[model samples]
Target: MGCTGPLAELGGGETVRRAMDVNFLGMLRLVRAVTPSMAERRSGCVVNVGSVVGTAATPWAGVYCASKAAIHAATDALRLELAPFGVHVVKVVPGRVKSGIGRANTAQIAGGHGGKPREWGMYREFTAAIEERARASQGAGATEASALARHVAERVMRPRPPREIVYGSLTALFAVLAASPVWARDAFFARRFGLNRKL
Candidate 1:
């Protein structure tokens, strides 16, 4: 989900619901869809693909961060809920996996703004920065999904798996934010990424 969105994809309502549905509800839906069978067997690993956004709020990334934070919360609860049934729940928190997800989100947001003037409040607030976030999400230094996947693959096979494993360096930074105070973290995120600059 890079850092932000186009803010107009659904054509009418705010894309807030869309973001929540995809990033939060979708994870729950998948777990509900699969957990029963695994419980019956008393064996199975459910590694949720979460994000750095789940841990801390980023500039231009409120909705995505909120939804993902819910995902992490759900992952933790589900882990305990399913533990009695012998289902292993591992949360995979990837930092910046270079994937089409970023590009698709960009295109969707960009397309949504077309024909609509840039003066729309949300668009004016987010347009250029979102474009940049998407671009940077795919750029160098962003950890590859395969690397994270390998870690997850190993974790599931282990006799004892971790509750959460952070993959990227930037993700670790977010972890620091997650543990820090609101003002400290907020100020850190706002300035750490150079978000204070003009769009």
Candidate 2:
């Protein structure tokens, strides 16, 4: 299951709820609706498409990252629970596979203000940077969707599917960040997102 949107410019309640609905709850609803049949059949593969940011909270996109992180955790639990039923739960963590998510995110954020900048409490000056961060994954060196699809397809078809699959641009960098100390991660993201500097 794949889903996403921009939440950096939205208020706390709206941002968190929107991200949770799309990134985490949507998958839960899908599994709830479909898992019974799969369990009955005693064979199935569920592939969840998450993001590298889910592994580590990045500045400016905390809501979206939180939702993805929930998916990562849920997927782990799902993998364990479904194994005995011959159901394979695969978590595909994509760093930045080329897609229209960036455009959609930009559109979603802009829709709230007719494509004009809206008042962003406390983060007023960093609006552009936040927008850039939303589209950052689509920049140069992003992995093509076809390649990611092929890789996932090949893996899921195996006798023993991987519990977690990580790929796409900046996958390694983000993985390292996810494994780093909290202080290091905070410092890195603060600097990268201009949070450490005065706007």
Instruction: List clashing residue pairs in candidate 1.
Output: 6-109
Q: What are the per-model numbers of colliding residue pairs?
A: 1, 0
Q: Write the per-residue lDDT of candidate 2 for residues 1-199, one digit (tens) a residue.
A: 2223234445466556766897799999999988889999999989987889889877767777788889999999999999899999999998888988788667655654466634567777777877777787789999999999998899989988998899888999998998999999999988887778855
Top-scoring candidate (TM-score): 2
lDDT (0-100) at residue 129 of candidate 1? 62
Q: What local lDDT does model 1 show for residue 178? A: 87
Candidate 1 C-alpha lDDT tens digits along 13-58: 4467777787788888998999999999998889887788777767
lDDT of each: 0.72, 0.80
Clashing pairs in 2: none
All candidates: TM-score:
0.82, 0.89
